[model samples]
Structure formats: structure tokens, C-alpha cells
Target: MGQVERAALETITPYKVEVVQGNFVSKDQIDQLRAGMSRQQVREILGTPLLTDVFHAQRWDYVFTIERQPLAPQRRRMTVFFDDDRFTRLEGDAMPSEQEFVAGLSKPRRNPRQVPLQASEEQLLAAQRDPTEAPPSTRTAPDPAPTRYPPLEP
Candidate 1:
């Protein structure tokens, strides 16, 4: 009964696709941010904010979330504050370095197989024997030229 219940649960389980959304600001990008920089400069550095509320005209929110199976969902948020259209400060979760961030996003191969870089002796000999000749099934005969043609002017 336990085995049957386990099989039933596995059959009914739905596959969940990875969901990654919002701006992904790296440590390098965040480091480039300056206190006196303008909104445009901040945008260029971190990309457009994910959320900008009308009530908080001077604040811009950058939110990032990753939902992947077999692992817990990850979320990061950064809020940039401004005064009179000039950048002031930012607050958020500790961001990963560019390299660290890339490493985290990459998944290891289940079974890595090495491919032979050099051709086998048999393959080399076959290629050298008839390099220009293609297989009979792939070869198509050219159409014969017409013996006569209608007058172009008529």
C-alpha cells in the first residue's frame, strides 16, 4: 500500500519550470552606484527598477526571484532612494559577485561524456578514398539543357 501511494504521488506530481524575473544586479554593478548619481545613471548601472510606486516617487525597487525545483526559491530586493531626482542610497540583500552569481546559476551535467577529437583510421581512409563522390541516394542528376527555345520577342 505504501509503494502504491508513492507511485500515485509521483504520477500526479507536476513539473515546475524555473521562474526567474526582475533585475539581476551583480556586486560589480552595485559597486558602481554613486550617491549623487542621477536616476538615468542608476538605471544604466542596475537596469530599470522592477517596481516604482506613485506614493514613493523618490524610491525605486529592484526585485529578483528565482523558482527552481529541488531547491528553495531565492529572492533578492534592492531599494534605491533619491532626493530631487538625484541618487541618495540603497538597501537590499547581500548580492553575489558576478562570478559567484554565474556559478550559482549554472547546473552540473548529469553524465558528462568526452567526445573524441581525432577521426578514426577507418573514417580517415574512407574520406581520403573518394572525397568528391557523394552517396548514390544523395546524388541528383542535372537537368539537360533544352535543344530549342521560344523567341523572346514573341
Candidate 2:
């Protein structure tokens, strides 16, 4: 390849597939874990372990990975160690709150819509009449209707 082609390749970032795999670890799930809790209880809160070693059955690993282009890949690992049948110590990256995690993944709205102001009947009539005047601001403005009718229901 020519020198220019090599330089162009270096400047361009290759596409990477968004990879979301393994267990989705959240703060609420991790909080449910307590010392001396049974392995089944921990499993209920955090779901099935991604890695269960035959050599070390007492420890369970929950791995979460996200791979996206340009941005750095994210990996979260939670290890739950059990002594016999009871849960023991917990270790790994600090889990993010559900709101925080969701917000981080979501992009903010680029263009937001503005709510239109409600116009009174008089204001509407005035607008129709002049087609250029500023809208009336008083709720108690005099009614411009040619005739007012009493409610038949009343």
C-alpha cells in the first residue's frame, strides 16, 4: 500500500459490533446479597453465574461486557464467594444504580418540543379579527361574542 493509503486507514476507526453479553449486573441485585445467605438466595437476586469453576465451586462469577466502536469497551465482574453453603464475601467493580446505568446508555434528545400556550375565546376572536395583534392576557377580558346564551342544562 502507498503511504497515503496507510495514513488514511490510521485516521479511520473501524466499525465494532455492540456486544452486550453475560449477566446484567445492577446495584439493586448486588444489594440483595447478604452475608450468610444461602447460595440459592444469591442466585435468585443475581441470576445464574456466568462462570462456575469445577475446581472452585464455592465461588461464582457474574461477568458483564459491552463493546462499542470508538468508545472504550466496558466490563463489569462480580465475584460471590461462599463458605460451604452460606454466602461469604463479595468483590468486584462498584455497581451502578439502575437510573445511572440507564441514563448513561441513553442519549439526550437533540431537539425538544415546546408546549403551546392555551388561548382564550376572546383572544382567539381578537386574533381572527386583527390577524396581527398580540393575544389578550386577561382571563376576565370582556366577551366579544355578539350574544351570550344561558346554559339550557342549568
The candidate scoring highest on TM-score is: 1
**Candidate 2 residue runs with Cα over 4 Å from true position:** 1-16, 107-154
How many residue pairs clash per model? 0, 0
Q: Which residue pairs overlap in candidate 1's backbone?
A: none
- Among all windows of 10 consecutive residues in model 2, the one with the lowest summed lDDT is 131-140
Candidate 1 TM-score versus the reference: 0.61
Query: Mind giving the per-residue lDDT tens digits that candidate 2 earns over 50-127?
Result: 999999889999999876654567789989999998999989999898897766675345336599899999877776
TM-score of each: 0.61, 0.58
lDDT of 1 at 19: 98
lDDT of 1 at 64: 96
